[model samples]
Target: MSNNRRPTIKTVAARAGVGRTTVSRVVNGSDLVSADARARVLAAIKELNYVPNSVARGLVTNRTNAVALVIPESESRLGSEPFFAALIRGVSGALAESRTQLQLMLVRDQAERDQLTESVATRRVDGVLLVSVHAEDRLPGMLEEMGLPTVLAGRRDAGEQLSYVNSDNAGGATEAVRHLLGSGRKRIATITGP
Candidate 1:
């Protein structure tokens, strides 16, 4: 093979004195190949510095091996909120263990939303993790309609049908108020966001 050409499966197979199918099986971690064939393929791969093309593998398997974390907030909000940073760190750490890629998407306007829609339509990600859900937001519905696997950080309402993870905000607030009242704070006020 020429030095200019990258090593292909066929080249590895030739070097290993095995068929292309045997090399493919070994590369893909299929146990169908005999031990001797597997060893030869491994040796050939190391010798040629062969690396499988992930794009080609994904096309053949119909899996992108990637997930999108979609946050519909602006960059300022994402940066300012400690919640967003912690969420990103947790998600990235989890995905790293599985060797999956994470795509962070910010959709603050119609243009960015349109881009997200295009990405989803193209099946660019295996799944989606959506954050900052609101009752009027149509993104969750759209993702459901497309049959994409989705999980939200919060629900739109009590009647939400999508999978979500949410904190007990009402319960926590009630507890806080109870604690304040018990401490004789008669003129306590609370601050909240819209």
Candidate 2:
């Protein structure tokens, strides 16, 4: 019997005839739980339509089920850049479908860069999505060395070892140029990210 009201740990616990702590442990994926108890908790959770509060669960298990979007650039660039905005929208849209939180990190200086590195090294985020890859950026290497699951928006011409997703800027540009040139344009100009 579910309504507009959301189910909580207490609801699942009561439905399972167990303590809230037991339900919490099960929801947090604690291996210490007994198999029989785990089954009951899972059944109860399903019956009650209970979705564990990730933030609350994060407090106990230290996994936020969240990802950090680390942009190593200026705020002005993010504000003015349509590419960044569109990429972020796509990222957030996809994440929202899965109920994941996005932590935005802007690294503008050496100190901020160091802080970002330390925070990631300390496991503050489950994963990281790095954007604005410069030719000589060190963050990607540092993140990879730390064993973090990282995705890059774009890579330098030398390419990156980490998984990444990006628009085919080069291919797109070439196609656009070909289109324009085919249409009888004598000159074409393209703007590329730095």
Candidate 3:
């Protein structure tokens, strides 16, 4: 029977009279489970209203079910930049829905960068999300070669080979200019930042 507290895999295992590993295999849809065990596990899941925690499932499957958001920027930039906040919010919001945890990595210098790279190499995180990479940055290539899933907020350049999402700055500027010209403005001044 379920109560106010949530049910875990162990609870389901006890109810099903199977080992935790067997329960995990069944929950993860591994073919190693036998017919009778699968049936029992399913029954226990239904009876106890068991909701498999993705984090626990990841542990049994040799995965952390966690992602690292690596931002190679100093505290100043992280504090001042609006994009970083927005990026964190968007990623965090989506991850929250899936019960996956996020590890924020703000690498400020070479020492921290080395540490972050070491963590990635040690398989501490399931995947990496890199932001604010320069045109010549090699982190993306290194991560890909290491066989880690990676995503970038924006590309280094037009010839960037990695998967990335880029802003349409030029398109937006062109549209602004066209809007002013269409409105019969005699002159339009463009302002930019350093």
Candidate 4:
């Protein structure tokens, strides 16, 4: 035994060979479950030290006005890039003005990516605003195919039919180069294509 806090309904379900819903009913003062099964789950919960996640409390109130903002990157990378942080601030500020909560999600694997896919397909969000999209990321493609109301912070590849807001990269570059030329830096070289 690791000697941690007791297990929760979710953990107990895994241990007792039952579904989370069954364990949840038992936990939420439901008398519908069979006494024998409930007892088994209770015992398993006590044996393991799995703390329940915040989902339990969320269930009682039946409210989670949270929107998941998925960013597929590492913490270090996120910190290094002002683009994501600024984008998030704008998104949060806009959402705050509308009195809606935002949930930031950082995808590190297929499971997390899949969750984003499900959210869009089910209209789980009033709208989804994607940022930092690569040229070949599959999530954006899937989201587009689902025809969900999505807004991208970056441009879609080639001919992808999706709604998005993008920075004026080309225009900004042009302005910068023109300024350099006017400033007598005629041999100035500008790097594009990230």
Index of the highest-TM-score prediction: 1
lDDT of each: 0.91, 0.86, 0.87, 0.72
Number of backbone clashes in candidate 2: 0
Q: Of 2 and 4, which scores higher on lDDT?
A: 2
| Model 1: residue 138 alpha-carbon error in angstroms | 0.3
Q: Residue 75's C-alpha lDDT in candidate 1?
A: 88
Q: Give the TM-score of candidate 4.
A: 0.55
At residue 144, what lDDT does model 3 achieve?
85
Pairs of colliding residues, candidate 3: none
Candidate 2 structure quality by residue, lDDT tens digits, 1-194: 54988998988998988899999888867898889999999999897879988678888877767799999888888999898899789889999998788888898899998888887877778999999978788888899999989999877765468898767867988898899999999977766568
Candidate rank order under lDDT: 1, 3, 2, 4
Measured against the true structure, the TM-scores of the candidates, in listed sequence, are 0.80, 0.70, 0.74, 0.55
Model 4 bad stretches (over 4 Å): 1-67, 121-123, 179-194
Model 2 poorest 10 in a row by lDDT:
153-162
Cα RMSD of predicted structure 1: 4.2
Task: Report the C-alpha displacement of residue 71, candidate 3, in angstroms.
Answer: 0.9
Q: Which window of ten consecutive residues has the lowest lDDT sum in model 4?
A: 57-66
What are the RMSDs of all candidates, in order?
4.2, 5.0, 3.9, 12.0
Q: Could you tell which candidate, 1 or 3, scores higher by TM-score?
A: 1
